[model samples]
Target: MEAWYMDDSNEDQRLPHKLDPNVPVTLEELQKIGVFHWKLNADIYETDPELQKIRDERGYSYMDIITIHPDKLPSYEEKLKMFFEEHLHLDDEIRYILEGRAYFDVRDKEDRWIRIAMSKGDMITLPAGIYHRFTLDETNYTKAMRLFVGEPVWKAYNRPADDFEIRQKYVNSLAA
Candidate 1:
């Protein structure tokens, strides 16, 4: 729903003094609180059949829930390309960057692409059907934590995007 940038990143966002320790988290707490992480809920997604196929092929049932971390990623462009092109079956593509820099380009309902930048301690939640793309640079050395809100569990990027065809059988299977 929102992106949270590192506290130190906003040197000008600080307040005067601290707040009452017993008080609830307030403006002063927010301004002074360091950026830690971000998260997305699962109730927002609308499933796609392709996602179910990927799950079945992977010896899983549903691409229901998943988390993504950039730093722990492997170094494979081909694999990365496929990973990115495949649309998430669960619909809501969520992420929280723990470290580094990156940008996400997502397609809206009107077919418009919107790019949201992410850095350490940033959070982003992508609603279902919002086609999305992500890129990481040398400076993009980042680490992220993700949460998926679907059933079974599980579920990235590179190269020119590819088209994914949906078969009627798979759709029917998913519907059932």
Candidate 2:
């Protein structure tokens, strides 16, 4: 996974809008904001030991695959718009990329945007209540496995969700 500060460009969102100075963000720094990452063999992900261990440890009992593309998705444009909106979830947002690539933009403690580029074999878990957004990269396609602790929840509270308890707890976590 590659991460860096997103440039404030008005160009297409699919294009890599890397910052001018190219400041990179490391996995360790991402951890400070409650983001977790792992790289696993996508081809054998169903039986991959590392993935199994993570699921077991995290109590992820539900899983499903989603293909995001103009042709594959019913309301591709609508969905992409929603996905790109800064939002927070009541539960952790977990995704394991199996094909194509995308970017996950997360807000740092100072509210700066850090774009995380993810591709096949990459798995990322954005802890509950982190204001973030996702979008397909230049390829405009991605197949990902979504995991959940139990029943899957698709609700996303658009930003300015600071009133929520989950958001409060997340802010407190960063203070720690």
Candidate 3:
């Protein structure tokens, strides 16, 4: 996985949350931000016993595949546009990369964009209401498994809106 500050001109400078160059991120550092990452040994599937156990424990009731590539994206062009735009959901956004790569640009407490590049076997769960967006890496391809606790809804609440006050406050609390 690759991560760096969005504004940084030098791609070689890898930083977590762009907090400091001297201070490498520790396990605590990652946990503090409410972003959970995990490595999977087997392919994730709704019917897989392990995945099902996780779904049951996490209250996830829905699973779907999102494939993005030149040929497959045309039908989803409109939706993909919105996906690339900064937005948040009322529920946590969880994704497991089944194939290819994608970059999830998430905003830190200070509002700096942290680009999290996910590849095969990488799984991430972004807390609800965090300002974030997604785009395929240079390869322009990604197939991921999306998990939801309820019926999946594609409603992406754009930023600077009042509708997500509760979630916004929760996200702000994590900063402190």
Measured by lDDT, the strongest candidate is 2
Task: Give the alpha-carbon lDDT of every model.
Answer: 0.40, 0.95, 0.72
In terms of lDDT, model 1 sits at: 0.40
Q: Please write out the lDDT profile of model 3 over residues 22-121, one tens digit for every residue.
A: 2233334455777778767436354567666777889988888878887886765565566768888877888989889888877776777777878888
Q: If ranked by lDDT, best first, what sequence of candidates would result?
A: 2, 3, 1
Task: Show how many residue pairs clash in every candidate, following the order shown.
Answer: 3, 0, 0
lDDT of 1 by residue, 1-176 (tens): 22222221222211111223322232222222211223322222235344334335434332222223344455545434454462533334556565565655443323333334566545555543334556554453555555455452344322222232322232333335
Per-residue alpha-carbon lDDT of model 2 for 63-158, expressed as tens digits?
Answer: 999999999999999999889999999999999999999999999999999999999999999999899999999888999999999999999999
**How displaced is residue 145 in candidate 1, in Å?**
0.3
After superposition, candidate 1 runs with Cα above 4 Å error: 1-72, 150-152, 155-176
- Alpha-carbon runs more than 4 Å astray in model 2: none
RMSD after Cα superposition, model 1: 14.2
* Structure candidate 1, residue pairs in collision: 42-149, 83-156, 84-156
Sequence-dependent TM-score of model 2? 0.98
Clash count, predicted structure 3 = 0
Error of 2 at 49 (Å): 1.6
